[model samples]
Each structure stands twice: as structure tokens, then as C-alpha cells.
Target: KKKKKKPRGSGGGDPGCPRVSKPSDDLQTSRKSGFFSALPLRASLRGYGFCMAALFLFCFGSLFYQLNGGAPQILQDIRHYLGKKFSLPRALPFPSQVVYNRVGKCGSRTVVILLRLLAEKHQFNLVSSDIHNKTRLTKHEQVDLMKNISKIPQPFLYTRHVHFLNFTRFRINQPVYINIIRDPINRFLSNYFFRRFGDWRGEQNHLIRTPGMKDDERYLDINVCILENYPECSNPRVFYIIPYFCGQHPQCREPGVWALERAKQNVLENYLLVGILEELEDVLLMLERLLPHYFSGVLDIYKSPEYKKVGNLTGTVRKHTPTLEALQVLYHRMRYEYDFYNFIRDQFHLTKKKIGLKSASQPPAYSSAFLRELTLRTPKPLDEDEELESDLEDKWLLWCPS
Candidate 1:
């Protein structure tokens, strides 16, 4: 046989391809040279087993991420590098508990009727309180009412003609709040007439509703009440809409910036969707979008002929528009109410836009003078140095980098 060139270096079998080392060969080399070399092959294999287990865990961990609706790490890394925020996709849970602390004469009766149908069809507990007259509860009453509401079964929607109750203040689990509001002047006019001559039902309904009212009180003229500044038509009473949102605080009843700001803040923090009565259809649409479980088929039910016939019965009879002069006085009285209503309306429109819904009525654009006046009314912040010094306990810095 031709003298076989002694297989090159330590490969010992072939010179043709220059021995291609396998991962097994590398492992063998590592095991033989390192601290492991002194141990048995079985001991070296134990380390190999640990490495294999780690790789297995890493693969399953990636699979687990994908199962819970997360993107792969490589794609997330690419998004990060591209300066895009990566949001992990997750299923949105339906809000089971909801509270519609209905404002008086804001078309809440119409909504409640629709809700009755919804509750039946959708099979959710609809605990609508029968107590319509009592809104502002005493401290003991608030605690009692909240306790009763808490005891109701889960996946329920509770509605009532009550002012906002701060569940958090009482340490109860706060429910998701939803409400409908109307133009301040329009709401006032509706209530003004409704108290005197009920709806399509009859005057008897008004009599039953306000049993203690005097005949003089029942037939009070809208123009006279507004122009003459009657208690029912003046400051605190005309300041109706704010307290419904601003909670049961005594200050909420007083017409001021504090109540207005507090109501606006509560709308942002507590209330889910505050719909306007003029845009009731859009309100239902938003409710369906926001709380699909409770309000899924609400819009369809509202549009039905059967529902329309029932809704017609609730319309305020002898509803008359106030004269321009009387309306001007009423508007001035409800300036703060108008401010809150405008804020809620704008927020509703913005949400509608976000969900690809078009509004038939757009909010009016303000003039430069009006905007300047609003800017002047806004609270001004102190300068940075002044703000820093005002709250600081120490005048001197503890440490500086440079």
C-alpha cells in the first residue's frame, strides 16, 4: 500500500478534507483541558445535560410569551431600535359594575327605559333605585346606601337620581360611573315646565311627583322666575349640573371656581363617559364602545319603534323656549354650569373622533377675546426658583455632581 501520510496533526484518520471538528469534538476538548478533565466522562456529561436544559427552558419561555399575545423578542427589539414604543397586546376585560347617577331631567328616564330592555336581554342585574326625590344623602345615609349597593350581585349596573358618592372616601370598591348631561339652560327649562305640567301621561303625574308643591309654585312663570331671581331660578339652584358631578360636598352646591374645577376633575377621574342629551345617539354609541357588555344592543333598542312609542310618553308637555332677555339672565346665572358642560362636550367629541365616529354638531370655536379671558382666569404657577424654595425644608443642597 502507498505509504499513507500519517493523518495530519491529531485527527489520525484523514488528510483529504482536513478533519472538520464537530461540536462533540469541541465539548470533548473543553472537558479534557479545563477543571473537568480530572473528572469522569459521566461528570462532563452532567454539565452538558445542564446546558441542554437551559436551552429547552429558553425556547418554552418564548412560546409562553407568544401564547399570552406578546410579540417575539426579535421583533420587539427591532421596534425598540426604531424608536417605537412596544405595547404588549392583552385582552380588555369588560367592566362589570357601572353606576349611572342620573341627573334630574337630563333625559335619564329615556335611558333607564332602554336599560330595562338591555338588562332583560343581556341578563345583568339592573338595580334602579325607586327613590327619586332624595339625592344629597346625609353621612349615615351615604354609608348605608353604599353598603346596600355593595351587597348587590356582581356584573350589575346600578342607576339612580343621586349626586356622585365618593366610594373611595368610604373605602368601598368604586364602580365605573357613566352619566348623561344636557345644555344647562335647556335642562333648567325642561325641569321648569315638567314640574308644572308633567309629560304626555298627564298633570296627575306631576301632582304625584311633587305632592307638597303649592299651586303658586306649580304654575310659576319661567320668565318671572328667571328675571326676578327667585331662589329656584337663582345662584345655587341654577348651579344644578355641577353638584351632580362634584360629589356631596357642601361647597359643591355653592356657585364658584372650586366646584367647577372639582366637577371637571371628577369627570376626568371617575366618570367613564358623560354624554350630552342633545347627542343622545352618540352617547349610546360611546357607551357601547366603552362598556360593550351592558350597552351592546342599547342603540338598536333605542331606535326600535316600540321603544320610540314609550319614549314619546316621557316628553315634557307645554315646553316653551324662554325669551332672549330671560335666557340671557339665565345664561349669566349658569356661567359655571356652561363651562363644565362645554368641557364634557369637548371630551365626548374627542372620544368620538378617536373611535372613528363623526359628530353632526361640532363644538363652537371661541373668539380670541373669550380665550384670552379664560387664560386670565387660569391659575398661574410660581417661578421655578420660587416654587422650589417655597416647599423646601433645607435651603442648602446636600450634594452636587460638579
Candidate 2:
């Protein structure tokens, strides 16, 4: 080519240079390689961020649950599940705040477990049953306690063996109240046995132990303690269940129609339900039918103690019918308790009739129908249908008549 001498100097190009057939392709390949080289760094950084976020969440959740005195095992899992899939309806017909004034020896163990289960399912904070502090609290201390209770997070489920008080003193938001009642005789027997034997589940109930009945010598002769007016059992009036449903007033402890009337009035007006231990299945089924969001098969709480392992549920033993003397004294002393129990029991039967339950053995009609519907609609293995899940929730949410 006459040696590159004939190259025209149109620009800075060297005419002797050979033109590459695919320069653009080579450049693209180099750019792609550079991007691939950076991929690992980007991935590691994202992973690190995710870990840090999860760690922060775990710590915060633990502290919140501890301070609230909670179902520690449950809240964490629920918090995580709710973070990604919060399904609580935005337009609920009622306030989500729940106050379970848990009464002792009233199947409260199973009730608490059921409550914790519901709390987890519904993504709510479940406060521990920490009302052991209720006894002997001064007015100042009571005020402080109420104030502290008010400060806890909202949409909270507070469970306490604490008696109902005029919470208006604390000026806190009113919550939906729920409680359970047991036959006064049975409750007294359970309390006596639980205190004497700790827990039937082979666990000690340190919080509920009698004060002077600590040592083995004292525990051996618990009868003496009772005869000597021990706070646990000396009181013949198993006034235990009375204070729970009524406000703080002298009449609450009185054994008369006034007390029963007041307690029953509170039951009919304030409480969502006052479940009976004898009819626990009906109670749980009724709860599921009325407040499905707060209950997911609570009967499982009783049927399986390890359902969540939060409660001390165990098998039943035949209750020893106290001698006629004991029953006579108990009836005379705890006359109000008997009346209240009778009132509630009568209402229970009336309610059963209203809900079409001719016998105590009958399951709630709504829940019976719902279970059949659910079984029919449940998806088979290897089948994924989101609409079906939504429909299930909708079915459970069928408008419950007040």
C-alpha cells in the first residue's frame, strides 16, 4: 500500500491501523465481566443488612414481651408473621383491647393458654397473669399499678387474677371484658388442692402458694392453718369469684340478692362472656362462633396440654364431695356465691335454649355448621388456593348477632 504514506490525514485516525471486525462486542464483554465481578459484594451487603434488621427486631420483641410479662414464646413468632402478612381487618366492629380478669381455680390455666394462642394468632400483646401483686397493695400502690397498666401498648390482652376495680381512676381506655366462673364448691376444692399440691402438672405454683404453708411441717397440717384462719382457705365464703365480676364495693362480698344481682348485671352488661367450667366445650365453641378472631380451636387447649405449653392443663380427677357439715357451712358462708352461680347457671341454660342447644352436650350450632363448611372447603395436598384461605376468614367473620 505504498507503505502507509498514502494515508489521508482527515482526522487523528492512523490509516495503517487494522480495523477490528467487532470492537463493540469486545467492549460489551468487558463491561459484563466488570458487573459480574461486583455481584458478590452487592449480595454480601444485602445479606448483612437483612441480618442486622432481623437482629434488631428480635431484641426489641424480646424486651417488649418481657416488660409486658407475656407469652414469650408466642409473641416473637407472631410479630414476624404479622410483619409480612398483617391480616387484622381494618374495619373491626369492636375495639381490639381485651381484659381477661382471670379468676383462679376456674380452669384459668387452660383459659390462659387459649388466650395466648389467640393472641399469637391475632398478633396482639398478651400480658401475663401477674396479679399476685394485687393483695395488700396500698391505695398509692394501686394507683401506680393502674397508671402503669395504662402505659402499656394498645390492642393489648391483659390477663390478671386481679379483681375488677373502677379503672376509671386510671382514666385508661375501656377494654372488652371477659371472664370465667366455676361452681363455688369446685373452685374452692381446686384452690385447696392446687395450693396443697402446687400444680397437678408436677410444677410448683410459687406465685400462688400460701404464705405460712411454705415449710413441709406447715404444709402437712394445712387443716390447722385453715382452722386458724389461714388466708388461703379459712374464709368459708369462696368469695373468690364474686369480686371478679363486680366493682369494688362492700356489697360484692355480701351474701345476698344485692350482690348476686350486681354481679349478674355486670355479667349481662359488661362481660362478653362468663364461661362455666362444666360447659367448657360450649364456652370455647361459643367463643369461636362469636369472636372467631380471638379463638382458634380453644378446645385444643384443654384436649392437649402441650398445645402451646403455656398453661398447666391436665387430666381431671373426681372431686371429693366435702362432708355435709362442710357443705352446710360453705353454703351458709358463701351464700352469695351460690346465688351468683345459680343466676349464671340459669342464664347459661337460657342462652343454650336461645342458641338452639336443647342439652348441655350440644355443640354450638354456628360452630358445628362452620366446622363442616371448613372441612369441605379445605384444600387438598399440593393444591394452593389463596382465595380459599380468604374465604375461610370470611366464613369465620360471619356477622355475629349481638
Against the hidden reference, what TM-scores do the models get? 0.69, 0.58
Q: Cα RMSD (Å) between model 1 and the true structure?
A: 17.1
Model 1, range 143-191, lDDT digits (tens) per residue? 9878877877667788887789999899999988999988887898889
Instruction: Give the per-residue lDDT digits (tens) of candidate 2, residues 238-259.
Output: 4667767766665665445666
Stretches > 4 Å off in candidate 1: 1-93, 362-402
Clashing pairs in 2: none
Task: Give the worst 10-residue stretch by lDDT in candidate 2.
Answer: 388-397
Whose lDDT is greatest here?
Answer: 1
TM-score (C-alpha, index-matched) for candidate 1:
0.69
